[model samples]
Target: MPILRNTKKEAVIKDITVIGGGVVGASTALHLASLGYQITIVDQNNSNIAKNSEHRTGSTASLGVLMGNIFTRHKGRSWELRKRSMEIWPELIKSLSTEELPIIVNTPLVKIASSKEEMIKMENLIKQKKYLGIDFLPDNYQSLPIWIKNKYGGLISYNDGQINSLKLIDSLFLKLKSLNVNIITSKVKYIKRINDNTRIWSVILEDGKAINSHIVIICAAAESERLLQQLNYKLPLTKILGQAIKLKFKNSQVNFSGWPAIVNIKGINLIPEQPDSLLIGATLENELSPDKKYLHQMLETIREKAEWMQNYLIKEKWYGHRAKPINEPAPILKSIEKGLIINTAHYRNGVLLSPACAEWVSLEINKFHQ
Candidate 1:
């Protein structure tokens, strides 16, 4: 473990390297850059993974649903992370919006209850969260959208919303560049301690390049396990496959105005990408490739509720791998060693939890200097 020290006259400025360029990594870089650290982000730039049908990263494949206030869990680590992120999201979005970045769609999230049992659960949740601006609607509610067919009631969380993950990352990078943070397009081969005494890290790239940093935070999702193995440190992480599809409405006059950006039916999410297009998806599987059967089954579930969905044509389909921790709670946000931190393995909640996790990484780095 490296020992970091600061002089009394002035605080030492440290070089920090983040090993992923996804939402989590980009958010971390932006947060650290705000703290006036020398930041460098390295990513392999696998942007074309969708066209190539390769292993897609979680950030790009996500539907970007932010269900913080709507989450069932009200207490525990998960809730804490979600709460913190929710608190930061508004300010973050406002700051970004000041720069004219359209990263988030500020709309409420509607979670429909498909079964009577689910309806009862939602009813109880509505009572419990009455102070949180959550609204419950019965099946006969007058304002329910005509497109959705529901026998059971639903809950609407006004504070929860959806994000445009791709735009969020792009906006963060733009902010990083404005802050003079260095962005590198490369793959890190491994990281090793420069010396036992100084605690500096030598981040070696595949191209025979080595960049030294005072701190290294691994936000590489499932790839973090392989990187840690190089240092003989083990963190059990597995990749969970999630698939989603985009659909375009055939009817040009279809009216979807004033609709919430996200509508979660059962375990599936329906997102509005545009007025005439919808994004539905996300099946969690333990395989490397997408399961067509599962994807269709999810679509079928949605189709059963909304017959109008039959008029929509599939525009695109994509899948990505999310990192899940085996036998551990998700979102391993902590410093394993003095100068080494791991903030990956967020699984499906990467988009929702990245901001809080990034703040965690920055605090850990600050602790070292203290």
Candidate 2:
């Protein structure tokens, strides 16, 4: 491992260099840092990207949104990894002493349905038998309650929970900083094939500075595909455009309305961060940004959810790309080269899967030394 000074400001290098500072990159750094690896991060956008990538990306989002259902589809080892990852929040909270972590307290992971058919679909889903028992959540989210039941979200599952994604990313970055991870601001210009493309490699920053390492993991979201292709590894991945919104509400029935997180109807999901306000999102597509047409549809969806929303205006908006690997629901963690690894195609579970993903990657890094 390279050296990191205890002093406040010093330009010391590290053994690991991560090519993104978003949640994935931050989580990757933090996990490895705890293992005593000298780490570095690079990204053009900081925490603010989560605040508003909608207008900036020309995308519009609705009140309810989703990341698809990794929770409901897990099987065996895949299911176990997700469950264990969900349980990491408590330790994550203490690690992030700063920013008040988003209230991920147990709330109903519901399938609130508007009609009988949908509710029946929910009933049939939970009853389906599989060794992994992946079909646990109701088929539709409408079956959920308006608020928490019995001081919590009810006996939901052993491992499912919510997170203030953006805030969580911010907190992770700080924690990694406290761990002395070096964050370079330039984009990665190219990769240096240390031996052969299949054996060892390093990367060159856009500025022409090369960061060599014994092991490298690519956590660069949609860019993961490009990274893999550059290494001659075939990865089945695609980028889906998603939009999110923040709305200020009025007289609402949803208690804990300010802090409840739900995967709501019409592909809309929300996490109310404040009283009378919630962050709603997500539309899926191959496009890079949301056109005006898509944005208008989003507004209409929110309007249909609650008549009272007619009075409530948007407090904020955001848009971003989520990567997904269609071949397998689980992330692709196999080595593309002897010294290089791939850790992307996480889809919307990016935040949810960070801890587990990082842990998996860190283990591989440690195994390299052995």
Candidate 3:
């Protein structure tokens, strides 16, 4: 009888609250709302859903590089998660068709080996591509761009796609609004469980307002650990700060829109954002925030390493933080207690992994009913 009561509570569960309005949180809200669950999304900044600023969130600052099979080093859980996420991209795009946002860029991905050892590894990965839909570009591959200095070798994966991260988040928000989902702008001060075993949680905001829900999912990225710590659940999540730069070619004749994203083994990448503008990024730093001096040096290093970028003009430079679980390569999805779900720590693959994580978390929550 007691178990039936819990199961009844689960089956009848209606109100769901999602903390953090990032891509993962937004996608979760969209899916849960579509499933007919009442959802309220709480975020510290409501502007994130409307316009992801370069200074605000990492998702917007990203070049939206969907590596797909090109990121062959990931295996086990990480690889599976990415593959599943890729599979859902088309469906997710169809759902956003009415929004008219830039849903996806069907572009290829090219990865260059940084060294001879890296080249060997690439060769092996290509030979062992299995069903990953990748192609090996031998050293003599003539289609290589003149600007690209691939001394080792290159591998191309044709199925990779990209999206404007900011627009994607905004589209999610629009989808949520169309579904009549409630959007609350506030910082969650603390989450209070109704009791040790009840299927309800109360999210207390910084403004002293509280919202009780049948379930609460935390997709707060870098802030997830602190919120979990407040609930006495310790998760080892590190905040890695990254900086990226946007450059436009000084000469109008240069066009990069059709170019596949060029990435090296060391993780330095150049992705085209538009015809004349290319987005080059990203130095992973141990610090939690960006230091002006260090960021300048990091950008300089990126410029020097990619000597071909010398012809481009700097448009803007920005930085954002991604969350990584200590010593863990994959994002985490776990239910600590009844109706409490943690969905965070996506690291560099947030855009690539959000869809699958959202789907996984939704299914995990639904399991309570079953």
Off by over 4 Å in 3: 1-10, 48-54, 73-75, 138-145, 261-265, 292-307
- Candidate 2 stretches with Cα past 4 Å from truth are 1-14, 47-70, 99-108, 114-118, 124-159, 196-200, 250-259, 298-305, 326-330
* Model 1 misplaced stretches (Cα beyond 4 Å): 1-10, 46-55, 98-100, 138-145, 252-254
Tens digits of per-residue lDDT for model 1, 1-370: 0111211223474688999988899888888877778899888884333443434678888888888877777899899888888878887876665346666556788888888999888888888777777888533433645467767778888888988876776677778889898888889999999997888888998898988988898999999999999999898999999998888898866556657778888879888778888888789899988888888888888879886776778788888999999979998887878788999999989999988888878767667643
The window of 10 residues in a row where model 2 has the poorest summed lDDT is 148-157
lDDT of each: 0.81, 0.58, 0.75
Index of the highest-lDDT prediction: 1
What's the TM-score of every candidate structure?
0.92, 0.76, 0.88
lDDT of 3 at 153: 69
Q: Give the candidate number with the greatest TM-score.
A: 1
Pairs with backbone N, CA or C atoms under 3 Å apart (clashes), candidate 1: none
Q: Report RMSD for candidate 2.
A: 7.1
The sequence of per-residue lDDT tens digits that candidate 2 reaches over residues 1-370 is 1121112222232367776676667777888787677777777555455355444311112221222233444467566566556556557666675545443334444434445565455445455422223244433233444442121111122233455555566667777777888777777766667876434457887777788876677877667677677766667777677766677766565433433346455545656667667676666767876665776786676566554445567777667667778677746666565557667766766666666777777666545532
